[model samples]
Target: MIQKLRQSGTLLGFVLILLFFALKLPDTFLTARNLINISQQLSMLAVVAATMTIVMVMNDFDLSVGSMASLSGIVAAMIFTAGYPVWVGLSAGLLVGVLGGLFNGFLVSVVGILPFVATLGTLTVFSGMAFLLSDGKTIFGRDIPTSFSGFARSGIEIGDIKIPMLTITAGLVIFICWCILEHTNFGRRLYAIGGNKEASHLAGIKVVRLRLIAFSLTGLGAAGAGLMYAARVASANPTQGSGLMLDAIAAVFLGMTMSRRGEPKVIYTLVGVLILGVLDNGMTQLRVDSYVREILVGLIVLAAVSVSSLSKRRQS
Candidate 1:
């Protein structure tokens, strides 16, 4: 009964906060336009969070996600600027993302490097590559294809509410990720590894291989996000992916707290990302200073983590 109450309390608190912000900022936060804007703003973060959840569930981390995303975006832009077809550019971007992931996986699994160190090294290398490829300049030109632009611009309208295509894509990706994590043996192995790597290995799980796959998927997701970002902005810069690492990590941790699971869950991650978006939107509507918003977000995350830790202790 107490556990149920705790769970309910956590959910109820989140709901109340959301409602309060909606009511307080009805003209800005609760409007359809703002809701659509929030969706578009957080779509990339949502993608990155999905992959981060997978990696965390496998007891590993990928610090190179932001770098990989930047590199992918640069490559995509270079391809398009070089007159290649949009599909070709997208494929090249995704391929590069996969290669980056595989490289990180090889280092961690085959070379016996720690996941953190391996990804950190790759992160720096990939970021440098992005800058080198772009010649430290943002890629912007009229030659950018119309199809690509439409990919990001297109939306669905329901009454007065307009939803961006990328927003719908994000929802689909989250649902697919949730299905993978909750309904598959691979997912079970991932959670088992997170709970106890040694136990999972002793049970004949291919822990190393699974970890590699997780990292690869993380890279894939980040690259996909970069493509969407480029499509939305119609250009790519070397610094396009900067700061994404922090947002992605925060979303993952927030999701974990809400899920109260040993392993990360996609649905919870999406919810957490929405919570963050709402907070940011609400603060912006109130004309809150950017620094103050950051501080508030940091405090909220810290409090959530503390609560989650305390709950775990009680359960134990």
Candidate 2:
């Protein structure tokens, strides 16, 4: 039993923390409204976290994701405000995101640049472009359609609980990602690359193509998140996605600690996002200062990563 518990410690720890928070703030946390709020608040992070996991699984990272998201949101808002259809605006945003991802892939694969360096350069470029497009202004107007807003605004009631559409969409995405990672050969190849890139390449796994696909998926995820956020707020600013990078990366790292396979998994990443969301909401409910909350989040992520790395080392 002790051995079994040690092997499954991360899942146990996640459960315990969730229960503790739910119990400690029962008056607020146990309510349906709060549950919905937590899900909605974490939706964007969850999307980015999933994408980041895929990138990490490919033994690469995309530092430009947050910037891409910001650019996508700004572009969507600008298009919408210019009398274009919402679908057209959404397509434009997604296209921009895909183009950014393709640029990163080109640098890393064709130019033989390191992933970190390539993405870092693109990050600054994309962010500057976003700022230039916005000209340091927030776009807001009442003409934004209800149909777009309804994508995030609607809710489903189960018993006394109302679950937001944003929450449902995030859940669906997580489920699909989980299936793809756990059941697909492509996912296995991604893990192979992460574990030993040279071996995977020698085995004819098409490392370049896999890495390109992974980066493209990251962009798609970020674009989806930006669209959702823009819809929720009914406005967009060039800086809207500035804070998402840290949160998404934190969730991805936290998730690495939870899976026994030593590979990033979608379900674990979603859980990690939920854990962070709950922490933030609970802290807010308890009136904790934002600075302290940020510090705690960072510490928690560091501790989890350290523990996970130690465990993997021991196992090896």
- TM-score of each model, in listed order: 0.95, 0.93
Q: Which regions of candidate 2 are displaced past 4 Å?
A: 1-7
lDDT of each: 0.84, 0.81
Lowest lDDT sum, 10 consecutive residues, model 2, at 1-10
Candidate 2 lDDT over 1-316, as tens digits, reads 3333433555666677678777888788878778788889998888888877888887688888888888898898788878899899999999988888878888887787999999999889988988899887877776566777777888788897778888888888777777777789988888898999899999999988888877888887887788888888887778788777778877877777776665777877887798788889888887889999989877877877777776677666
lDDT tens digits by residue: candidate 1, 1-316: 5455444444565687779887887667777788889899999889989888888887688888898888899999899989999999999999998888988988987798998999999999999999999999888767567788688999898887778999998888787777778899998888998999889999999988988887888898889888888888888888788677888888887777766463578877787788788888888888889999999899887887777778777887
RMSD of each: 1.6, 2.0
Predict model 2's lDDT versus the native: 0.81
What is the Cα-based lDDT of residue 316 in candidate 2? 65
- Clash count per candidate: 0, 0
How well does candidate 1 score on lDDT at residue 86? 95
On lDDT, the leading prediction is 1
Count of clashing pairs, candidate 2: 0
